[model samples]
Target: MDMATTTSTATHTSLASVTLEVADPEAARRFYGAFGVDTYIRLRASETHSTGFRGFTLALTVSGPATVDGFVAAAVDAGAAVLKPATKSLWGYGGVVQAPDGTIWKIATSAKKDTGPATREIDEVVLLLGVEDVKATKQFYVSRGLSVAKSFGGKYAEFTPGQSSPVKLALYKRHALAKDLGVPADGTGSHRIALGSTAGSFTDPDGFTWEAAAPPAPTPS
Candidate 1:
């Protein structure tokens, strides 16, 4: 099969939005939107649907140790399942939380390995793609015009987004991600999220869906 490309393909530098089809959009909105001004929760595509890992994760990168701790604490307090408690790693200090929406969040701080007092701001946010075949998925994105910032032994990879790139993207082995989340590696059924890009509508090698962002409908006078 041919690689799918969008009609109005988003540039490598645009922010991509994740569209989740939830049983209760209102509940999703209340929970997700509270995290930040940018995070959004909208309507579902269908009344009947399924939900799971969805092959992606929401990463909140912070510069302060307090910020990471605060974020982690807040996530847990807000009904998130703690996947990994706050700790230090090669990349820096960080932890993982599975939000109520089934979106896994990695709260991290590369600036300091030590914990500190609470801070309110975030350094950056990234959308991480978890796939069964890390190497092949990395190749697919590379072929699609994205450049890599760093890479590891066919297990982890990071891509540098153009200045205009909306959301920073990365790739990780699905099983490894499952291990991180403390869950079974096997995930199936519809991913239950839609991505709209100026780049256009296309399906990835892993079955994640993307479409062009539709303009707002005109209101009647």
Candidate 2:
């Protein structure tokens, strides 16, 4: 990878959408629909060889414990496997679920308690990529025009999303991210996700691909 390449042209790059490669788009569609996150992602049918962790996770940030539980329960009822049951933690309450299509999702919130009845509103959708090195990957993205919104040394880094981007991007150490997601760190083959961005096409240091934005489909006259 060309670590020194300047992507000044990509200074305006922002994540436009995320597409998940799955074996069955219909099945994935149903699962995501039932899980209440269908509108947040796109899906394509793929039989690419992949096993274990897949090196990443999509997280949903909600309001409180009730909301966390609400989403987790919906995921479970929708045929998602529970990697971690909803529970209170030092930082907040959350749980992990693996969609039938093999995409892992973490639903969580900073508030430990619910202030009112649970609603299925998602506050944020974050695509967290597990990288070999946080600092190096951070610099790699910076060179590609992504601005750092937050950094925690070699542990984690988050980039500001372009105004129109729906998903927030972040980086985390592979092993640590796996641990947090309650899974093994070892994996191979494709990440099975493609990112649509305004920065043109390029692959990041971690093998995550970013492509130029697709023109919006025309409406019926």
Candidate 3:
């Protein structure tokens, strides 16, 4: 759900697109694109990453409570099912929605009360995976070039974003993740979120997918 960063020559993990497989790519784009930044919609499907999540959620950090409400209302209007209505949450004002594509979306603001219009409506997209072994999962990423900005024993861990990362990647212990989503921790198999890298295609300890991609082209001088 968060990250810890540092200087390292071999921090090989680059922040990549957290690709979601949907029946209709256009529809997914229209919906999620509004709530997330730099959302890349792919028509090509990955057999492994296409399976919907049994234990995960994508979170968007908004600027304030008012923006949180506004976005949730739009999601509900577009036929998303409300899992939790906008309200003051333990972590400030927040709400949840189940997208038509069967992905869980959460909108939250760090401020508890209305803070007016958001300067940036969609701040970040966090790929929160529910893992059976957080420590093992954390190590798997580290070996593949991910750097940890912060970690806690074996319950949770966060990865620092490499250049070009569009979304944040994180791991949480299974039951704890379930608690965060108000669901059961009895999920296994495909997580339906793909972490892409120029590094190549492979699967993580929890079976979440990551694909091969070239590093982003640098901006002109």
Candidate 4:
């Protein structure tokens, strides 16, 4: 079944904001605030019957191991459950955490060592949707006028965001994403998330919805 009734198709979409549907908006707001990511996403109340992996994750690409560790620590202190501890791997240092509201987040970096003092600075925030078929989903977004910035055959694809976009969009195989996040692959019901953009609203092939909305106002530094 479709997650929600989508209204229109997306065109020239750049991910301006992401909204997470939570059961407790106030609690979520508190958690995100303590975790230092409240400014990156919005929240709404919904008792959506979502379970297991939601087929997506918000990935934080930061500077180095220290930064990754710093974010992971903050999330844990903010009431997030750690799915994986920050550690160095073939890719780099990173970890996974499930927010109090059931959203999964992966904090990672390509640099294995600390370059300077740790800070709450995010280099890039990518919204990765786990899809059944990477190629088909990539084509769907392409038809919607989202330009492809990176493609790895059937394994993954990423879209180029407009200058004003706050988040970048990417696609990966569903099962693979779950494995990467150290979670099981099976899931059902609402994704409990929405992507906001300048483009018109539409549901993607994987049931992820994009809405017509302005980007989030820039938060004071």
Candidate 5:
């Protein structure tokens, strides 16, 4: 079955924010503030206050020095494990943190004015598929009217359909990909990723899954 057809049934929402675990909330806050996110919320648990904020929210995060310490403290107290302690990255005003769930969070202090190169807004979503045989998988996609955009070290390849908005359908070897993601190689089926305009999924050789989907059509303004 062509699983890509099912993406239309999925919800279409713009990515708002993501919350992660922090070892030292205060440190995380400081680090993230320096990176560019502004923290507008903080909660604490104490003897007098057995109850605290019910859920996490980053809607008001911004960048600044004044709120950094508090933000980091709050994050740690809420159960985040620090991955990379706050430090400058080579690319820009940002720091990397691995949350308790193994999600990597990149906190930035300032937007890089000199990104060095101008690129188009992603017209296509890239699906990182895990496969057993790269050549066979490429043939499947090619038969479906997709063409290769590029190949990464001969192991990973990206394919794009001619009629679509230049979105990519990519394939990678399962075991190798799992190692790259630091995840155990036991999972099967596909994981879904959404973009602004289209959606699709790919199943690779070892039964690893990947998806790239575009959002639903927009409503009239």
Candidate 6:
């Protein structure tokens, strides 16, 4: 792998979008669109499919269903434990699965949100982690007082540590996560986890970085 030549054009904040390399372009498009996300770009040969949002983008690329199946199989073959086999959800179209790395992937339609006026109030912040082992990582955090909100398989998982003000910490396999971020997997540990309040840092089992942050204090009334 070329180390020095790594360049990323993707510029978005939070947990942007998890891109899955699949087999069918149209099917993947329709699958995500059904979740209410608009498909902005589609490329056949490059197998690139992109969905746009006000602040982020989710992408998928595949030749067809068979190809997607093969990719899933490859993950399993590579020692990735399936957290959830690819299956449809009651809420909408798409499927959910986990990899051995504790990365949970939801290959579903875009999530639909009720229209509302924008406010200064924060909605959510996404935390990303690269781990050597997903299962062990999940256990480490859970033992540290974090609660598992959801687990897909060995590939990915999500933990929520708060209620009124929520935080989402996601764990992903190093290599697959590198591909999603379009970067190299050699740099493990917390790449960057954001918090909505006072900024604080925590280290996971793999020495990944994590943050608990808040906006700067405001002037007294």
Candidate whose TM-score is highest:
2
lDDT of 4: 0.87
Q: Put down candidate 4 lDDT per residue, 1-221, tens digits, no spaces.
A: 22221222444567777999999998998999988888778888999899888999999999999989889999999899999999999988999999999999999999988889998999999999999999899888887877787788788888887676668889999999999999999999999999886778999999998889764656658
Q: What is the clash count of model 6?
A: 33
> Please, what is the whole-model Cα lDDT of each candidate in the order they appear?
0.67, 0.88, 0.70, 0.87, 0.38, 0.41
Each prediction's TM-score against the native? Answer: 0.76, 0.92, 0.82, 0.91, 0.37, 0.38
Q: On a 0 to 1 TM-score scale, where does candidate 3 land against the true structure?
A: 0.82
In candidate 1, position 114 carries an lDDT of 46
Q: Enumerate residue pairs that collide in model 4.
A: 8-201
Model 6 stretches astray by more than 4 angstroms: 1-124, 164-166, 188-202, 209-216, 219-221
Over 44-163, each residue of candidate 3 has an lDDT whose tens digit, in order, gives 343443433467787888888888878787788776888878888677988888887777888887888765655555777777788889878887878888877778777777777656
Local lDDT at 39 for model 2: 75
Give the Å error, residue 138, model 4: 0.4
Residue-level lDDT tens digits of model 5 in 1-221: 22221111222311211223334455555544443332321212112211211111111222532233333444455445543344443533333333332223323344334333422111122334556677677655554345566655447666543343332345677666555434455642222112222235554344333345333334338
Q: Please state the error at residue 217 of candidate 6 in Å.
A: 2.8
What is the overall TM-score of model 6 with all chains considered together?
0.38
Model 2, C-alpha of 186: deviation from truth (Å): 0.4
Point out the higher-scoring one by TM-score: 1 or 2: 2
Better of 3 and 5 by TM-score: 3
lDDT of candidate 1 over 54-74, digit per residue (tens): 677777877766788888887
Which pairs of residues collide in candidate 2? none
Which pairs clash in the backbone of model 3? 4-149, 15-165, 198-213
Ranking by lDDT: 2, 4, 3, 1, 6, 5
Residue range 1-221, candidate 2, lDDT tens digits: 22322223445667788989999998888889889997778888899998899999999999999999999999999899999999999999999999998899999999998899999999999999999999899888888778778788788888888787778998999999999999999998999999987878999998998888775434338
Error of 6 at 180 (Å): 1.3
